[model samples]
Target: MGDSNATMVTEFILVGMSNYPRAQMVMFVVFLIFYMATLFGNTLLIVLIILTPVLHTPMYFFLCNLSFLDMFYTTCSIPQLLVNCFFRRPTISYTRCLTEMYVGLFLGITECFLLAVMAYDRFAAICNPLRYNVIMSWKVCFQLAAMSWAGAFVLTLIPSQFQPTQFCGHNIINHFTCEIQALLKLACSDTRKMEMVLMINSVIDLAVPFSFILVTYGRIGQAVLRMHSAKGRGKAFSTCGSHLVVVSIFYGSAISMYLRPQGKTFSDHDKFVSLFYGVVTPMLNPLIYSLRNKDVKGAFWRLLGKKMSE
Candidate 1:
C-alpha cells in the first residue's frame, strides 16, 4: 500500500513564474538572453584557454574546468525553464525531475570542491612562488580535478539514496525546476532523516569550502603584506580579488538556499535565491573573469586578430 501510494505521482506540474502572468513573457525573454550569454561566454573562455599557450597554466586549467561546469550547470535547468515559460501548465515526468535534481546536486557539489582547489592553487602561487609550478603541475591539477568530481559523486549519490522515492498526491513544484527542497515538500513519507542528510551535505559541501576559501585568502593576505614589491602585491591582489568576488557571489546565494533551517516551507524568496546562483552566477562567471583578468582579454584579442589576419 505504501509503495502504491508512492508510485501515484507520475508527473509534476511546475508552478514556475505562472503566478505572475504579466511577467511571464518578460521573464522568458530575459532568461533567454541570460542563457545565451552564459553559453557564449563560458564556451568562448574554454576555447580561448585551450588555444592560447600562455593560458596553459594551472590557474587557467582549473578555470577551464569551471567554465565547463558553469555551462553544464546552466544547461541542466535553464532550457526547461525557458520552455515552461511558454505554457500555462508546464509538467515534467518523474524520471526527468529526479534526474535533474541529482545532476544539479552533483554539479553543485563538484563546484564547491573545485572552488576550494582553486583557492589552494592561489595560496600556493602567492605563498610559495618558487615551487608554484611544481606544486600545481599538470599531473597534480588533473588529480585534484578528478578528486573533486569523484568526491561530489559519492556525496550526492549516497545522500540521495536515502531520500524519499515517492511523493504524495501533491505534484505542484513552486519553483521552476525540481529543486530538492520543493520536491521534498511533496513527499508523503517522513522526511526527517532526509532533511538530516541534506543538512550534513550542506555543511560538507557549502560551509567547509567557504570556510577554507576564507582561510586561504587570509594566508594570501599575510603573504601579500610581506611582499616589498608594490607591483607584485598589485598582481596578487588583482588575481585574488576576482576569485574572491566569484566566490562571494556563488557561495553567498548557495549557502542561503541550502544551509538555512530545513523543513521550512519553500517560498518566493527561496526561488529567487536559487535563481541567483543557478542562473545569474553562471552567467556572470566568465564575464567576471575575462573582464577583470588581463590574460583573458589579451588572449581573446590575439585569437580574434589571428583569425582576421588569416
Candidate 2:
C-alpha cells in the first residue's frame, strides 16, 4: 500500500493563478515583469557594489549578499510560475517540487539572519560611530555572513531530513510554488510532528531575528536622537531608514505567512501573501537602497562616466 501510494504521486498539478482563467495572460505578463526586474535590479546592485570601491562599507557588503540572495530566491520558483501561467494544468515532478521547497526555505531563512546582521551593522554605525570601523571590520563582516549562511543550512537541512518523503491523495498544490505550508497540506504521513518542527523553526528564523532587529533599531533610534550634529542625525536616519523599510516589508509578509497556525487548506490570500515576499520584496530591495542612497547614485554616475569615457 505504501509503495503503491508513493508510486501514484509522481507529479503535482499546480493550480497556480488558474482560478482567474481569463486573467492568465495578464498574470504571466505581470510575473514576467517582476521576475525580470528582480534579476536586473539585484544583478545591478551586485555589480555596482563590486565595481565601486567607495561603496565598500559593511552595509553594502551585506546588501550585495542580499541582492544575490534575492535573485536566487526568486529564481527558485518564479520562472516555473511564469511558465505555468501558459498551461491549462501545469505539473511539477515530486522531486523538483521538494527541491524548490527546500531551496526556498533555505534562502528565506538565510535572508532572515542576514537582515538581522545588517541591522547590527546599522546599530554599530549609528550607536557606536567611534567604533564602527573596528566593530565591523572585514574579518567580522565575513564571519557574520558565513554564520548566517551556515546557520540557515543547518536549520533547513536537519528538520527536512525528517519530513515525510512520500505524499499521496490528490496531488494538487494550490500555490504557485511548493511552499512549505502548502506542501505540508499534502503529506501522506502524520504531519503533527513536522508541523511542530516547522513552528519551532519559524520562531527561530522569523521571530527571534525580527525581535533582534526591532531592539537594534530602537537603540539606533535613541542614539540618533542624542546626536547633536544635524548632519550626523540626518545621515544616520537616512541609512537606518532604508534598512528598516526593507526589514518591515520582508518580515511583515513572512511572519504573516509562516508564523501563523497551520490550516488544513491553503487559500488564495495565502498565495498572494507569498508573492509579496517571494516576488515583490526581492525586486524592491535594490530599488529602495539605490534610490535613497546618494553613495550608490554617485557610484553609478561615476561608473557610467568612466565607461562612456573608455
Candidate 3:
C-alpha cells in the first residue's frame, strides 16, 4: 500500500534436500520431464479453446485462462527448481523472489477462483439448462475472469508489499522457490500480521471456492439423477464429469495445502502438495478434458488428421 518500495534482499538459496546426493540428480530429471509436459499440455489447451469454435463457450473461455495461468504458474517455480536440483547451486534475489511470488500467487489464486467460476458455469448449464446461454454469456464470462485476476492481485500483492524480514538466522529455504510460507519462515520480524493475512486468505480461498464447487456439483448431481432415461443420465454426467474431476484435483490439493497448514508435525509435505497443483494439474488438465470429452476428442482427431494430410 506504500508508494515507496521495500528494501530488496540480494538472493535466495533453495535448499532442496541437499542431504540426499543421488536423489537430487534423480529429482532434477523427473522434474524436467514434468516441466516439458506442463508446457505442451497447457499450451495445447489454450489452442484447443481458441481454435475450436465449438469450444468458444463460457466454460472453454475460462479454461483457456486457466491454461494461461497454469503455464506461468508452473514456469515461475520449476525451471529455477531445476537449477537448484541439478546444478547444485540455486539462488534468487529478493526482488526476483517477490516478483516470482507475486506472479505465482496471482496465477495460482486466479486459477482457484476461475475454477469456481467454471463450476458455476457448468452448474447453470446443467441444473438450469433453460437459461444456460443467458446466465453464462460472453460478457459475464469476461467479467468473471477479470475479477479472478483482480481479486488475486489485490489480496496477495498487498501482503507482499512489505519488506522481507531479515533471514540472518538461516538464509536457506527448504523448498524450490520463494513462496509466501517459505519466505515467512525466513522472516525475523513479528510475523503475526503476515500469518494472519495468510490465514484470512486461506479462509476466503478455501471456503468461497470450495462451497461454490460443491454446490455446483450437488445441483449437477441432482439434475443427473432426475433424468428419465439411463442414456440421458449418462450423457448429462459425462458432460460435467471431466470438469468435476478437474475441479476435484485442482481444488483438493489447493485446499489441503492452504487449509490446514498448522496440524502437520512436518512441513516437507508442502513440496509434494505444491507439485499436485503446480505441476500435475497443469499437465493433466488438457489430457483430462480432451481425452474424456467426446467433442474435444473429435476436435483433436479432426485437427490431427487434417494436419497430417496437409
Candidate 4:
C-alpha cells in the first residue's frame, strides 16, 4: 500500500538555484554580502532607535519591532542559503528543515499583521492627528504587536502539528531554503486537504491583513485630500512613504508566491520570488527606511556625533 511506502525520511537534499557548477562561488559571495548587510543594517536601526529619544514614539517603536523581525526573518533562511551555494550536493536533516520552514512562516505571517497595524498607525496619525498620541499609546502599540506575533506563532503551530503524511518517505526539496510549498512537493500521500488548509491559512494570514492595509490607506488618502495646505499634504505623505514602498514590495512578492494556482509544479520562477522575500527584502528594508526617513538620518548623525565626542 502507498501508506506503507511513506516511511520517515531522515534528511532532504536541497537542489537550490543554479545547476551550473561554476556559478556556486559567485552565488556564495553575493549572498554572503547580502547576509552581512542585512545583519548590520537592521541591528544599526534598532540601536539607533533605542539610543535616540526622538525616535521613542509609537511609529518608531513599531519600526524597531520591524527591524528586529527583519533580522530574525532573514536569519531563518539566508545563512542556510549561503551554505548551500557552496556545496555541490547540499542537504539538511528533517528536523532542521521543518524548523526553518516553521520559523520562516511564522515571521512572514507576523510581518503581514505588523504591516497592517503600521497602516493603522499611519491612518491615525493622518486622519485623526488630534488624538494620534492617545490612539497609539504605548500600551495599545504593545498589544497590537503582541497579538500579531502571538497569532502568527499559534497559527503556524496548528499546521506543524499535523504535517503532511505524503512527505514521509520523500527527501528532496527543490529550493535552497526549506520553504513550505517546496517541502510539500516531497509528499507522496494525498495532499488535497493539506493544500486546502494552506489556502485557508493564506487567506487568513495574507489576504485579511492586506485588505486591512488597503482600507487604512484609503482613509489616509481621504484625509490627505481634505488638507488644504500643500505643505500639510507633503508632510503626511513623507511620514508614510517609506512604509508604503515597503508594503508594496513585501505584499507584491508574497501575493505572487502564495496566491498562485495550487498543484502545479514548483518552478525556478517561484524560487526567485522566494529569494526576493526571504533574502533580498530584509536587506532592502533598512536601506529603504533609513534613506527615505529624515528623522532616522538625523538620529544616525546625532548618535555618530556623540560617539565621536566620546
Candidate 5:
C-alpha cells in the first residue's frame, strides 16, 4: 500500500501565472522584466559585498546572506515560470516539483528567520554598539543564518510527510510554483489538522519574527528620538529606513494571506498579495538595502569598476 502511494507521482503540472490562455504572453513579458530585475539587482548586491572591504561589517554580512537567499529563492521559481509561460505545455515532473518545493522551503524558512536575525543585528548595532562585535560575532551570525535555512526545512518537512497527493484532484495550481498552502489545498484527505499545522507555521513564520523586528524597531525609534542633532537623526533614520521598508513589504502580505483562516478557495486578490512575500520582497530587499546604503553603494561601484577593468 505504501509502495503504491509512493509510485503514484512521477510528474505534476504547475498551474500558475502562465496558465492564463488569454494574456499569457503579456504576463510572461511583465514577469520577465521583474525576473530580470530581481536577478540583476540581487547578483549585483552579492558582487558588491564580496568586492568591497568596507562592507565587511555584521550589517552587510547579513545583507549579503539576504542577497544570496533572495537570488536563489527567485531562481527556484521565476525562470522555470518564464520557460513555462512561453512553452505550449508547462509540465513539471514529480521529481522537479519535489525539488522546487524543497529549495523554496529552505530559502523561505531561511528568510523568515534571517529577518529575525537582522532585527537582533539592529538591536545590537543601536542598543548595544559597545558589545555589538562580541554579540554578533562571526560564529554567532553564521550559526543563526544556518539555523534559519535548516529550521525552515525542518518545519516544512512536517507537512510533506502527512500531506496526501492533492494533485490527484486538481493538477493545476493557480499561483506561481507549488506554494505550500496551495499544494495543501489540493489534498483529497481531510485537512483540518493540516490547516491547523499551516496556521501554526504561518503564525510562527510571521508573528515571532515580526514581533522581534517590531520590538527592535521600537527600541531603535527611542534611540533615534534621543539624538538631538538633525544630522544625527537623519543618519539613524537612513540606516534603519530600508530595513523598515523590507519588514513592511515582507510581513504585510504574509499576515493578510496566511494568518487568516484556511480557506478552500484562495482569492485572486490574495494571490497577487502573495507575490510581494514570495517574489517582490526578494527583489526589493537588495534594491532597498544596496541603493540606500552607503557601504553597499561604495562596494557596488568598486566592484563594478574592478569588473569593468578586468
Candidate 6:
C-alpha cells in the first residue's frame, strides 16, 4: 500500500534556503560562484597531477582520486540548487530525486573511505618510511582505491532501496537538495526503522573510518615525536598537514550533520550544514591542498614552465 501511494507522488517540491525573492537571487549567484570554483579548483589539481610526472606517487594518486570525487560530488547537487533558487518553488521528479540522493550517497561514502585510506598512506609514510614504498606500491594503492569505490557504491544501495518505498506522498522536501535526511522527513510512514538503518550506515560510513584514521594518526604522531632531527619532524608534519585539514573539514561537517539524535527537530540549520559539506568543503579542499603543499606548487610551476616554452 505504501509503495502504491509512493507512485502517486511523481514529483517533489524543494523548499530552498530563502523564501524572500531578493535573497533567492542572491543565493543563486553565490552558489553559482561556489560551483564554478569547485569545478576549476578540483580540475586544476587533477590536471597538474596528471601532467607532472613528479606527482606520480601513491599520495598524489589518492589525491587525484579525491579531486575527481569532489568534482562529481558538487556537480551532483549544486547545479540543481542553482536552478531551484530562481523559482519560488522548484520541483524535482521522483526519478531525478532518487538519482540525486543515490549519487550524493555514493560520492559521500566513497570520500569517507578514501580519507581513511589516505590516513593509512600517511601512517605508512611517516611511521615506517623504510617500508613505505613496499607497502604502498602501485598495486596496493590501486587495490585500496578500488575497495573504497566498490565498497561505498554497494553500501549506498541499501539506503536507496529503502527510499522509494518510504516517501509515501508528502512531496515537499524542505531543503535545496534531495539529501537522505531531508527526504526522510517527508515520508508519511513509520521512519524509525529507516532512521535506524541510516544511523547504522552513518556509523559504519563515518565513525568507523574516522576511528581508523584517528588510530593511524596516533601512531604517526608517536613516530614523528621519536624523530631526532627537527627537519624530519617538520617534513612529516608538512606531509600530513593538508590531509589533516581536509579531513577535519570533511568529517567535522559530516558527523555534525548525520550522527545526531534521530528525534531532534530538523531545521533550516540542516540545510546550511549540508551546503557546507557539499559545496563549501569541496571548493575548499583543492585550495587547502594546493596552497599548503610545496610539492603541488612546484609541480604547478614546472608544468607552467613547460607550457610557456611551448
Q: lDDT of each model, Cα atoms only? A: 0.91, 0.91, 0.78, 0.86, 0.78, 0.87
Best by TM-score: 1
Whose TM-score is higher: candidate 2's or candidate 6's? Answer: 2
* Comparing 5 and 6 on TM-score, the stronger one: 6
TM-score result, candidate 1: 0.97
Which 10 consecutive positions of candidate 1 have the poorest summed lDDT? Answer: 1-10
TM, every model: 0.97, 0.97, 0.91, 0.96, 0.90, 0.95
Candidate 5 off by > 4 Å: 1-10, 87-89, 166-168, 305-310
Candidate 4 — worst ten consecutive residues by lDDT sum? 161-170
Q: For candidate 1, write residues 1-310 as lDDT tens digits.
A: 3655665788899997787778999999999999999999999999999999999999999999999998999999999999998889899999999999999999999989999999999999999999998999899999999999999999998877777766757899999898999998888788888888999999999999999999999999999999999999999998998899989989999999889785556799889989988999889989999998999999999999999999
Give residue 217's error in model 2 in angstroms: 0.5
| Model 4 deviation from the true structure expressed as Cα RMSD, one decimal place | 1.5
- Model 5 RMSD, rounded to 1 decimal: 2.8
Residue-level lDDT of model 2, residues 81-103, one tens digit each, is 98899888899998899899999
Candidate 2 deviant stretches above 4 angstroms:
1-7
Full candidate order by TM-score, most accurate first: 1, 2, 4, 6, 3, 5
Instruction: Report the lDDT of model 4 for residue 307.
Output: 90
Pairs clashing in candidate 6? none
Tens-place lDDT per residue, model 3, 225-297, is: 8878898787677768887888888888878877775531226778678778777888888888778778777
lDDT, residue 173, candidate 2:
89
Runs off by more than 4 Å, candidate 3 = 1-9, 261-266
RMSD of each: 1.3, 1.4, 3.6, 1.5, 2.8, 1.8
Candidate 6's displacement at residue 127, Å, is 0.5
